[model samples]
Target: MRLVVDLNRCQGYAQCAFLAPDVFAMHGEEGLLYTPEADEAQREKLAQAAAACPVQAILVDAVDPPAEAVSGER
Candidate 1:
């Protein structure tokens, strides 16, 4: 899945960085930086980061389960 942040709405709060360091970080001048594509393991953390944004700048694409993983053998 992909993570998108609306810089226009961001206020450099860095909450995303704290919540999902693997996906989000602060640039030299406090500008937010992040990986657009994240592994499935990081999805929940990314969601938390998005919700934690004070200005609600973070956005996440809805993730679809992989075919084999959704077979539900377990």
Candidate 2:
């Protein structure tokens, strides 16, 4: 999956870091550093991070079909 964090909108709240340490980190400057492509195993954590961001800066995109079908699909 692909994720993008809007640095301009981020307030360095660290919620993303707490929720998905593997994909999100707090830099020494108090800004955030994150991976755009997260492993499939980290999806849940990443989603949590996205939801936890107070500024709503985190954006997640799936690169491929999920292992499990989505609820709306057959």
Candidate 3:
């Protein structure tokens, strides 16, 4: 999965960080930082983080399947 946070829309509420510390974090006082690419195991936590964003700044997108997986190759 991929995570995208709009800095312009973010208000540094720290909700995302609270919900998903492994994927999101607050830098100092006015900044935010997060992982762009997340493991499949973190999908649920990532979703919770996105939903917890009061400013609706977080965007989560499914990563495209690998070429081998799509082609059914070994």
> CA lDDT of 51 in candidate 1?
88
Candidate order, lDDT descending: 2, 3, 1
TM accuracy, model 1:
0.80
Clashing pairs in 3: none
Off by over 4 Å in 1: 63-74
Worst 10 residues of 3 by lDDT: 64-73
Q: Using TM-score as the measure, which candidate wins?
A: 3
> What is the lDDT, from 0 to 100, of the residue 41 in candidate 1?
94
Model 1: lDDT equals: 0.86
| Candidate 2 Cα lDDT to native | 0.88
Q: How well does candidate 1 match the true structure, expressed as C-alpha RMSD?
A: 6.1
Candidate 1's residue-wise lDDT over 1-74, tens digit each? 77788999888989999999999989977788899999989988988998888999877876563566656586
Badly placed stretches (over 4 Å) of model 2 are: 62-74
For model 2, residues 1-74, the per-residue Cα lDDT tens digits are 88898899999999999889999999986878898888989989998999889999998984575767658766
